[model samples]
Target: MSHDALFQLGMDLEAHPAPRAERAAGPRSTTQTEDTIVAPVPARDADDRLDHFIEKQGIRCAGAHLIIDLYEAERLDDLPYIEETLKTCVEEAGATLLHIHLHPFEPTGVSGVAVLAESHISVHTWPEAGYAAFDVFMCGDAKPEKCVDVLERAFRPSRTAVSELLRGREVA
Candidate 1:
């Protein structure tokens, strides 16, 4: 490998591991139950250009998908608002909502996941801690930032980190 190639390889090895949920945890809400539905948001072809952006960003993966995960949420009552916020974002971007789930908590907010054909969006909130956790995965013409706006409006998290993953990798 050339010097630049070797340097690039070294950088990849140093990146931190990504977060993933092993299983859904936390208290379940009774007011609103877990729901799964399919609502595809329509988008213009211009949105299909995400593949080029991903390559330009130097991401190493097989397909185009952006996953956004949020942690340390402090509210659950904000679930409705969060959902509306996300829907607004998805609609604005012309994507679809394949499925959506919202569970209301005891004194605070809600925990749920909006499954999109493009990918999915999830959230967990803790009012006592004044924090919340969220995830968004957008593929193809899907726009993930729209969901993020809803999350920010509901949780107002002080800190957040984003991870971009390339799906459909074939290992031989």
Candidate 2:
């Protein structure tokens, strides 16, 4: 999408009505003056505005980055397997894969990156620790969360934690 469209979306989202509570409260504190009167504080609706903005934007929303931490993983030592799994994950997520690079450690472990049109997915594994860390970042219509299922299936981790962050959120 063009920057102008994005800017318009932000503007549309910002045009929310002020809360009734704030409007009813009016001025909480005022200074008494003979010739000068203090101005009332403006209603603070930053949190409400942000919530409304995100809601209105919907799927046309900002990019998403999924940070995954896996423990007791089964295939941290297999570089080739990891490379293929990541490719499949990217495909399943409806993202276009541009390129992929995989690296193997001296004796064990693997690291790989799969570049995509929307963004990228990267993995760093520690075979000795049975752990792996993955970053899946995608913008536009791509669904980064879909990759989590692929990761869980391929790695067979005993425990997993995932965090989803909205990247490049515009609030102007």
Q: In lDDT terms, which candidate is top? A: 2
Model 2 clash count equals 0
* Candidate 2 residue lDDT tens string, 1-172: 4433544543331234335664465523222222221223334465532112232137434477899999998989887798789878877987777777677788888876787766789999999999999999887557788999999999999999999887656544
The number of the candidate with the highest TM-score is: 2
Per-residue lDDT over 1-172 for candidate 1, one digit per residue giving the tens place of the 0 to 100 score: 4433434443331233222331134222223234556655555486554332333245433334445544554344666676776677667655667677777778766677777655666777667776666666565556566656666665666766666555654322
How high is the lDDT of residue 126 in model 2?
92
lDDT of each: 0.56, 0.72
The C-alpha stretches of model 1 lying farther than 4 A from their native spots are: 1-75
- lDDT score of residue 146 within candidate 2: 95
TM-score, one value per model: 0.56, 0.64
